[model samples]
Target: MFAAFDRPRISLRDAMAEALTKVPDVEIDPEGTFKYILVRVKDGDKQKDIVRGTKAAEYHNHIFDKVKPALEALGMECECLGGGKIEHNGKEKKIRVFGESTAFGKAEHSVSVEKLKTVFSNYEITWSDDKK
Candidate 1:
């Protein structure tokens, strides 16, 4: 026997997961228990030079166009955190990922760190939550 209310919750989780599949190579936290998803670009040595100038802006725009909507579809308020530079290996590098923050709904959601890693594996996308 199960509570009738539990069905809708399960449905929503499934729906959210289904929506996420639209984004190529994306992974949502399976727990879906995050308050915010921190998206940051990794500034590794080789990528330092390429993710600069117009290229960076273009990448951000692409994220806005592609990633933002997918998150929004899952009921998240997406915030764009433009380009940023970080010091890695003692070198200044431009961050590539554009999505920085997101507010989650009152339900558990799934987050695929691996998928995010794969998609922006070169740039390094990270998520932040109250739990952290």
Candidate 2:
């Protein structure tokens, strides 16, 4: 018989989903979060504002450290952009965190997607260039 220690480990995606519930102004999109990270890795230069508010920024900053090594292993470099501002519809909005990736391409993108699938196998991930 299998020991309790042999039980499956909880995935990072699931852990993130659970942690996200405490973050302010974030609609919990477990699948979308993975997709967003993948897209950031694929694009490699585009800066996407992920969330807003101080609590959200703090959350992203804290989580990025845990996620950085995984992206690096897939040949991508990522950073959390804090204290940034962007003009949206003639109003200056504070950007909680920006998602930016560097040094990744088609191969890395493919591999990253597969890795995410393995980590978040509970979701059916669809590839889309559109940032929704």
Candidate 3:
């Protein structure tokens, strides 16, 4: 049995995963927990996508605020950190993920590369399982 509540308890990572379905060009902590979300932000549309050049960051914030609860229902965490930009392809891509400096999963836990590829698509994304 569960207690009744008005709002759902949502962490930050879940939000980022959903955002990936749309914005799949950001870096996350190796683990699935919230630790790093480093990307530029925009209005989640093409205009902002080109102008501000941080669609991933924008969607990151959007998920934490709007859809985090939904993601929690599915079971995950979502977080937002400071702003940053990363070099990818021939341009600097904005970066934003989840979690603070305290999350253990940040550098400890790991995720399935195949799964991440499924989410982020295969363009410039590359990974080699260190554990293997």
Best by lDDT: 2
Model 1 alpha-carbon miss at residue 118, Å:
14
**Lowest summed lDDT window (length 10), candidate 3:** 44-53
Model 1 scores a C-alpha lDDT of: 0.33
Q: In candidate 3, what are the lDDT values of residues 1-132, reduced to their tens digit? A: 355575697755556445545544433433222322322233223210110112344433443454345434544343333222222342322222222222122221122223334444643443322322
**Maximum-TM-score candidate:** 1
User: What's the CA error at residue 27 for candidate 1, in Å?
Assistant: 7.8
Give the clash total for candidate 3.
Answer: 24
| Per-candidate TM-score against the hidden true structure | 0.26, 0.25, 0.25
List model 1 lDDT by residue over 1-132, tens digit each. 668857645555565555444433433222212222223221211110012112222333443455556555645444433332221211221122222323222111123334334544554444333322
Cα lDDT for residue 91, candidate 1:
26
Off by over 4 Å in 2: 1-109
Ranking by TM-score: 1, 2, 3
- What lDDT score belongs to each candidate, Candidate 1 first? 0.33, 0.34, 0.32
